[model samples]
Target: MEGSCKMKRRLLMFTLVICSFFIAGVVSADEDILLQQLIEETPTGGILELEDKTYTGNIAISKPITIIGKEGTSIEGGGTGNVIEIRSDGVTLDTLAISGSGMSRSSQEEHSGVRVMANDAILTNLTITNSFHGIFLNKSKNTRMSNITVVGHGANQLGTQGNGIHIMRSSENYIDNSYLEKTRDGIYVEYSHNNFIDNNTMTDTRYGLHYMYSNYNSFKENNFIKNVGGAAIMHSDHIHLEDNKFSFNQGSRSFGLLIQTSRDIHVLNNEFHLNQRGLYLEQSTSNRIEGNDFFQNEIGIELWTSSTSHVFIKNHFNKNKVHALTVGGESNNDWFENGVGNYWNMPLLDLNQDGIGDDPLEYSSSLSELVEENELAYLFLASPAITIYEKANDLLTQHKVMAFDKYPIMSERKPINVASVGVGIILAGVGVYVYRRRALR
Candidate 1:
């Protein structure tokens, strides 16, 4: 019995020894594997903690993983293909700098620092440079990209360099607190919707923000400064732009904001300064433009005739060479709504001590001179020379009236609005709202 027991104990000891050897061999093999090979071997939902070293090679991740890079850790592509290709959902990448993707002349082969084909990915604090595209998302959704800095090749040539953050057919993404410069477009979204882009600074790009065929999006508190073109919203609708600063975006063809073929847009409390045109609306309809500051622009607002049902109220049009102009549209726009109109830097009188003007202000055109010297033309009779010049010019030129602001405010509406003083007080609520929004952000 004692001998049999000893033999069984030896067999148990032999099994344990083999198990120990197998575990030690697995650990050593894992330590010897390269990062690329390690990623390939890791299963789904693994967390990879990278050391502070450079990993050179193109890495493709097809499983959900959290890659946490230590400071000074980088992934370089060696100038070929995409640096990191993510094909799985719920991937999180943080604290890494990626660069050196191959530049291709063809748009189809455009190389990117990171290409995301997954949903619900989070990319934070990444620095991307020297690539065709900084980050490209294809059919991604619910992605959170924040604190990312992208420096492109500084090429504004179309189809050569891609956007800083490009979203194609993605929706419900949150991109905030990011900076992008020197790319084709800073943030370009196509066929994307329900996205929130807030507090982003984009400069020196072709378009600071460009959207096409996207709708129901809101971009607020963004600074689009010193760009070739500020922003272009084309073929979209139901967009809300609030409290944005469009500054120093000046060129002959460039403007602070361009709205084309869009409808139901709300542009409120925005600061448009030092641009060629503050607001250019082409074929856009039913837009409400209120409480905006249009200062130092060559043209404050230009409304093309294709735009209809526009409501311009309580906006300050000051120090612009041309406060407002309209072309090729019937004067069917509501210049004044709810007895409140815009504040113009024109000669106005409120002799009755009321804050509002006594006479209905006329946004005069060359066609106003066509009103002949008769009892019906009583307003022009106050200035006989003006009336005579209008009559003579009308007889000579025969130009028709374009637009009229019948209730122009007599005083400049303060950015801080006071809703009710006597009659037609500009609402100070919007100013307070704007101030609070900026402060909270």
Candidate 2:
């Protein structure tokens, strides 16, 4: 009986060992299959898996493949050649860091970190740093870029010869949810069309957003803060700007938005604050401005001769140093809301108790022209000359500056408690009178 029991135990142990070996073989086979697929498909599909190691080579991708990375993967180009050039269509790049490219300095020919000459490609979640041009796309179409970070250190302030993201002669591209900092131009689109730039943050760049000879594009919900050269849109048309913020962009020739030789554009609901000039329109016409906020700027809007036939409606202009509108030539056919006026922070005397001032707000031509020439005219804002001008306007209009629409829609359009302004004014007046009387005594 003991021998029979020993035999059964040995048989059970042998069967268990056989089952374990079979399971191990299956797992190993699955791993080998995956690795084999990766290696086999790499040459045709051009998949170069990235790790923390440095790879120095000129790789041209001719087929569609995804080059993925384990976290902390870096591709170092060694500053002698182009890195990861795409010449094929339908490529995807994600979660990789590429650096050390950019050999050519000619504006026409330059090497970038990732150069795409293909169509229908997507680049996402890439960190491209310390390169001449971060991402350069030339003569490509139907490209999409999102969640990309392009950083150019400027290499001792010589400034990048190329742009962070350069799209030249490319069409139907979309860039969204990206952050571009410390580059020559954050994003430069030249001779492209049907592009969309939305929800991006750009800083410390020459021009945050530049569209030269590009048409029919849209910029929405982007924050361009502290950009040095500001934004320039020249020789473009059919552009639309909505819900963007341009703030603290101050310099001699800097402006929040510059439109030159552009037509049929619409700028609405944008906030421009503390900029040298909130908006500079030169030789651009047929634009509509509505529901925008311009505050604490050197000049709210500077219109050179090319700005004509523009409609300014329901825009809030407050605390700006110069005239709200500077009409240059007599042929400039611009329109403003007659009764619905902008806020200048100047007192309006409602003598008839009608809630609307009885006179037209006569903006001074000399002052406007002077401000157009010199931005420092803002320093003399509180001088007696301004007071005299206000009085003269009052006399010309019978103590009525401008009439509000009985109920004008206040833009930036907050609900105002009338009692608050009234009580504060009364208290301020009482305090001033008391102080003056005490000083006399």
- The per-residue C-alpha lDDT of model 1 at residue 233 equals 93
Residue ranges of candidate 1 with Cα displaced over 4 Å: 1-33, 41-43, 107-109, 155-159, 351-354, 364-403, 412-441
**Please, what are the lDDT tens digits per residue for candidate 1 over residues 1-441?**
999999999999999999975543221112535767867655567667677777876888888877888789888888879999889889889999899887886646678899989899999999999888899988999999999999876744656788899988999999999999999999999999999999999998989999899999999999999887888999999999999999988754578999999999999999999887788888888999988999987667877778889999888888775567665545468877666688887777767554555566655444223332232432332344644665676678654544466666777744222344523433566677889999999
lDDT of each structure?
0.80, 0.74
Q: How well does each candidate superpose onto the true structure, as a TM-score?
A: 0.78, 0.74
- Candidate 1 global lDDT: 0.80
lDDT of 1 at 29: 18
Candidate 1 pairs with clashing backbones:
305-329, 417-428
Q: For candidate 2, list the clashing residue pairs, or say none.
A: 283-306, 359-401
